[model samples]
Target: MAGVFMISDHHFGHKSIIDFESRPFADADEMTETMIDRWNAVVGKDDKVFHLGDFSFLNREKTTAIVSRLNGYKTLILGNHDRGRSRAWWLETGFQEVSEYPIVYGGFFFLSHEPMYMNKHMPYVNIHGHIHGQKYEGNHYFNVCVEHWDYTPVAFEEIVRRVVPSEEQ
Candidate 1:
């Protein structure tokens, strides 16, 4: 079945991220292509993908071309680094939807580029990215950063299973 997936911090065309994140790639070009390959490997042409943030640092033409090469219907939740262009620009670049702020999903999950304050008592889970390589210690927080997920998009069902307590399972 086609699935809903999530991932973040692609940082396409940003060479320094390879060093900053200690990614196992030779350069930005390699990093970008490898991520694209991994993305296409798991995502189908009809899948829906929510990109949490920091999608890319490349110019509009390059970014759009990259998006065209990937599978799935993409949606963007603006990240700190995504401010260089407006929401319309992102939409024009191939993201079907672009959000300026965090959004609620499935009535119980908070989706955002950055982690929101969530606790077990709050009746909500935060599925987010942006603190790559680091994570908040709690069941209510789920980090979808590629750095934490083998540089692949994670299935939404997988995230939901994590939010469901062991006792319930």
Candidate 2:
């Protein structure tokens, strides 16, 4: 089976995201190319990538072009920005699946486009995105946004390391 990965808030083709998020890029093209390269470096053809949301701000053709170049079997957890577009539109861009609601994965993580409320008392961790730079102040809340994760898809093992105490590993 392919490795599982997660990421969010790529904001591709959006020039304002560079300034808004303080991304270190000369331009949108640079950001896009660099992000694609980084993604391809870590993800393989058979890898499964769960993109939590705010994937791109580009039109259909442009978005399709970007998605086609990335390595992975992709799934999108639709975010606020992902709204208004039809599911068919997203699937046409090459995503294997698209979801507007939170998905519980591995029986221990709640994956969502926006951060879900989480506490230590809860049985599962909330792995999410949406807040670009702001920190989620809880051990049970893991932010998978690009800004927090060096603009690359993170491996499931890494998330496990973060959420599982060393003693339990």
Candidate 3:
């Protein structure tokens, strides 16, 4: 089976993100290239990647070019910064699917761009981004931002391992 991965808040071509997030890239171009290289290293052409949001801040042509260079069948869950754009715009950028609302995946994970509040009593967990370096309390919330991850897409199995006990797995 093709691997399933998740990532968020790439902010490609956004120079300020480097300063704001303290990303180690020298510039937007460098950040974009490094991120593409890192993404391709882990995600295969046939893999599915769920991008939680804020994929890029580049223009249409550049954004499309960057998206085309990445390896994966991409799905985007629109973030706050992703707004003010049409669905057609995102589709043209190469995302296979785009959603403005949260989606329940595998009947267990609630996927969204922004973190949702849920308690331990809830049966499902929220896998989201938008908080950047801010920490989310409790096991019910998992942040998939590039800052939280090693600036790469993470496998669903890894997320499961972090959230689920060995006995349950």
CA lDDT scores, all candidates in order: 0.92, 0.92, 0.92
| Candidate 2: residue 148 lDDT (0-100) | 90
A best-first ranking of the candidates according to their lDDT comes to 3, 2, 1
Query: Which pairs clash inside model 1?
Result: none
Model 3 — TM-score against the truth?
0.97
* Per-model TM-score versus the true fold: 0.96, 0.96, 0.97
Q: Report lDDT (Cα) of residue 40, candidate 2.
A: 96
| Candidate 2 error regions (>4 Å) | none
Give RMSD to native, each candidate: 1.2, 1.0, 0.8
Error of 3 at 103 (Å): 1.0
Worst 10 residues of 3 by lDDT: 116-125
* Candidate 3 per-residue C-alpha lDDT over 110-152 given as tens digits, one digit per residue, 9 for 90 to 100: 9999999897799778999999988788789999999988789
